[model samples]
Target: MPGDGPRRGDAFEHDIQVGALRPAFEAAGLELVEIDWRAPLDDFEGLSLVLLGTAWDYQDHPREFVTRLEELGERGIIVCNPPPVVRWNAEKRYLRELERRGVAIVPTVWLDDAGHGDVAAAMNQFGTDRVVVKRQVGAGGLRQHSFSRDAMPDQDWRMGRPCMVQPFLPSVVEEGEYTFLFIDGEFSHGVLKRAAQGEYRIQSLYGGYETDFTPSAEDLAGAKAVVAALPFDDLLYCRIDMARLHSGELAVMEAEAIEPYLYPEQGPGLGERLAKAIVARL
Candidate 1:
């Protein structure tokens, strides 16, 4: 697996899945080595596969990251989730494409370049007083911010870049978001993630907590449709996160195919299942 090496301030250096997944790979008769993605790849000559375990810092240097991934592809190294899937999922605009294919997505108004006036326009377009704005390419809730039409607009989240704005769904606070885990298009497990009290972000790094969840039939149907609507179907793994809106319908919060945190706690031996799925892909 290609991952980030220990750094003094690297937030994902302590990812537990790296260690947790080692045994599964071994059991599958494959050798697993965690290599620093930024380091030289001279030692990976015999490596059969490269799975992105926790290269969370890819967003820090997206151009270089994509370049390296392309280089690996040119060298005939197998990359899980595929390069097209990574390129598409790395940006949030994929939600719009999903919506076009009849997948229910949280209502969004994309801005090529957002300004204070654009934020106001987005609120009007969304027909809501409050909206959430986030950069097109980001993780860990970075650059995500909420703005209220009643209060001063905080366009800082845009950071003078392309952004997408959506209505703030109260469901995120009222009831947690549901995440459906899939390996090779097969559903494996589900988890419910809730933000800390008085918070809106549901990432564990932000004090959010995840718990095992049993999806209702409606939720399962919705999640399945979302996955089916993906542009590509041979993804090694995917995590579809959805929230129940006030309208009593589920809206996709994200259909992450690239490096989503697979909550192994929800399903014991999930890494084994993932390892097997990856091996089958090869």
Candidate 2:
């Protein structure tokens, strides 16, 4: 696992996942090593599999980080989900492609420093009373905000960073968020994430809670289609996050291909299943 460092006190999820995965890999005759994701690229040599685990710093310098991984891929190193997958998934614009392919996705508008003026126009088209403005490339609910149509911040807010504007779906408050965990394109488990009392972001860092959830046949089928549409042929694992729209339709919120938190706390054998998947790929 390539992360910041050894798990700390508040990082219980990180500890549990790394701890469980380490023993599972050992029992299967594979040696598991934990490295800092921000370590120099030179350290990756001789490593068989590079799991792009957590390193918030990498997300901030994604282009450089992914470039290094791509170089490693050229030498036949196996990077879970792969570098191309990471490059594509890192940008929020991928949502547009999914929508064009006939997948249901939350309506989104992209804004760079040059496109700040378009925010109002785009939000008007989505026809929502409130919209969410978030950095185009971010994780864990960092730098995300909700704003009413009449209360957008000044253009200075978009001066140095690219942002995405999406209409706030009221259904998030009513039906909670659903995340489907898949290993090698097959269903493993699902979870329902409820945000803290009045917040809309469902990240645990933001006081959200997740519980094992069973999806309806329709929800399961929809989630499957979203994953199947991705271009990866050897995707080791992924988490597909979704939320209901005002029209009672499921829409893709995010496709977490890099270091998504797999809620193994929900079941006893989930970690074992994931280890088996990794072994099959090896």
Candidate 3:
């Protein structure tokens, strides 16, 4: 597993995902080593498998990250979630692909060399005055920002960098983000994460917190449909993030097929379940 960001206290300090998996993996007669994806390594030879852990820094060097994963794959070391899947999902543009597949997604507009009029166009397209801007290939809320259509600045970021513009979903701050975890394509657990007061980002790094959530039948059905709409089967792990719309419908915010944080602590026996999933695949 790959780890990055501020490391203080114990090595597994705030890493519940790794902390939970370690014991279960060892119990299954396997050794687990957590490695930072950004660290220099000659090769991935000698490894049974490489799980893409919280490689939060990958957005800074996506090509290098994919190259490393490819190296591991060519060396016969299985990369969970698979390298091809990572390549496809690493970019936010996959949301557009999902929309094309009939999965409900937040209305979005892809932009490159955007001008002042493009902002208004996005607002008009989504029928909303506020919009969220995000990089095409980013994670952990890298460079994600919200701006009023009329208040957006003429910045150089919109010139060459690729980004997507979407109407700001107020439900994120009102209802919260719902996440469903699937191990080996089987549902494992679901959690609700709320942003900090007056904030929109729901990651803990942004002071958000997780809590228990009971999804409606519609929620489950909608999420299931989205999962089935994906092109692959037999994924090692996946996290589907949904938002409750004003009309009480669930819209996919993201289908994390890569290094999504699986909050094992939120569900009983989830770590063991994940371990079983991995062992079964091996």
Candidate 4:
């Protein structure tokens, strides 16, 4: 992991999130504190809630992360999205479940270990020349690959971990990804994340950028439907990421229930909204 750009996904994003939420949390008589998720469980004592904020490295220590959250929840601490939800969301295969539950998502082929041969097969299966392969437990576009039939990896090249393969969607590059943030099961705001030129991943770490967006009624309804499809009914927060499919419907790219960046810049009222929701829960 040497030369990895930053310890977290985006330093500026973390700063903005804290800046926006801290004053609002204070206004509601709450104090905001940042803690390492690996800290002693007793360190979480006396906290009314843990937002799972900025645990960006959790993908590398997935079980530990979820176990820690589970322990916190067992101690009666409020863990936003909760441990169970985090566990379910940790694996990308949950998309299959969402699809089964009537949520439209990018068509994906799950693989335990994907090599060049598998990539070829996936492209054949999806009937597309270009495809994307992503770790089942990844974040911030880390360890993701985009391949075209003409530019396949060598035969021995393998993604030595569980992953999902999907046909490369032109909409990702043409229209960018859409993020809908929800607070207490209600839509809070929308952000359009555009990848850098020549890139397909719409994460800030990859030079992607965000802009405030107001979706049309049909698209907003599509995002809300994804939220409604989540198995848990008591979620405190969710970020539903979607992309416009060729069919003109917004299909889910991700249903981020764990530690998603809420575009505070796009949603200036995010702080107050979060504070109100947190206070109501207490």
Which candidate comes out best when scored by lDDT? 4
Q: Write the per-residue lDDT of candidate 1 for residues 140-203, one digit (tens) a residue.
A: 7877788786674655634477788888998998898999999888898999999999898888
Candidate RMSDs in Å, in order, are 2.4, 2.6, 2.5, 2.2
For residue 84, model 4's alpha carbon misses the true position, in angstroms, by 0.4
Question: How many collisions per candidate?
Answer: 0, 0, 0, 0
The TM-score of candidate 2 is 0.89
Candidate 2 vs candidate 4: which has greater TM-score?
4
* Residues 1-282 of candidate 4: C-alpha lDDT, one tens digit per residue: 212454554767778888889999999899998887877888889999998677788899999889899899889999997889999999988899999999999999999999999999999998899999999999889989999988998988989999999999999889899999999898999999999998898888888999889999999999999988888998888999999878999999999999988898899888888999899888
| Native RMSD of candidate 4 (Å) | 2.2
Candidate 2: misplaced stretches above 4 Å? 1-10, 114-117
Best by TM-score: 4
Which stretches of model 1 miss by more than 4 angstroms?
1-14, 154-158
Model 2: ten consecutive residues of lowest lDDT: 1-10
* 37: Cα error in model 2, Å: 2.0
The residue pairs that clash in candidate 1, if any, are none
lDDT of 3 by residue, 182-206 (tens): 8887778889999999789998767
**Could you tell me the TM-score of candidate 1?**
0.92
lDDT of 1 at 165: 83
Candidate 2 lDDT tens digits, 1-282: 344456533367777777777777787787877777656767777888777655545668899878877877876778887888889889877887878778899888777742435666667788766877777788777777777757876765453577788888877776789999998788988999888898887877678888889899999999998897786767888899999987777899998887787777764566677778877777
TM-score per candidate: 0.92, 0.89, 0.91, 0.96
Model 4: lDDT of residue 2: 13
